[model samples]
Target: TQLLEQSPQFLSIQEGENLTVYCNSSSVFSSLQWYRQEPGEGPVLLVTVVTGGEVKKLKRLTFQFGDARKDSSLHITAAQPGDTGLYLCAGSESYGNKLVFGAGTILRVKS
Candidate 1:
């Protein structure tokens, strides 16, 4: 079984700060997804990357897939208190395959 490792399991920062979180795996994936979860709610899909070196942006958030498809990163710029939540990364080995999830990163943005 493959595992995705997320770094800096916890983070606490002031509002308007910029931060980056990472997810990495030894195995390549056909696609990778990023999600955010708030208290008492299920994770909401943020973005997905299928191509190597692909980058996507949503508002102040940026998502990137590594060249080998074995890693991914999420960066938040000028983060706001609303951004406080759990960030998760999931990868699938093939189309329609089961997804392997990383442990997750917890972020707290204080106003």
Candidate 2:
């Protein structure tokens, strides 16, 4: 079983809405990654945070890693239909490269 925790198993929002999701874990990791997956395809890594208290942004999406290295968060601004997908958070112990992923959060953005 995976070790990470993801909140909001499903979310639906109108275009232009802003939303946030979270991933939490009690175990410390060397790196944490966020991914977005579309139907019938593998997920695309959105960002990877290797340092505690790190933050990264891609267009309207913002990602943050907790200072304790055991949690992370993703925030989307001005949601669009193109942003609809399954969002997953994964973590790996220091350089182990064996990822443990959360159950995924399904987001549906309506225009």
Report the error of model 1 at residue 96, Å: 2.7
Top model number, lDDT: 1
RMSD, every candidate, angstroms: 0.8, 1.1
Model 2 lDDT tens row, 16-77: 99999999998898899999999999999999999999999999999999999999999999
lDDT against the true structure, each candidate:
0.95, 0.94
Query: Can you give the lDDT of residue 98 in candidate 1?
Result: 89
Supply the global lDDT for candidate 1. 0.95
Question: Candidate 1's residue-wise lDDT over 32-100, tens digit each?
Answer: 999999999999999999999999999999999999999999999999999999999999866567889
Query: What is the C-alpha local distance difference test score of candidate 2?
Result: 0.94
- After superposing candidate 1, which stretches have Cα over 4 Å from the reference? none
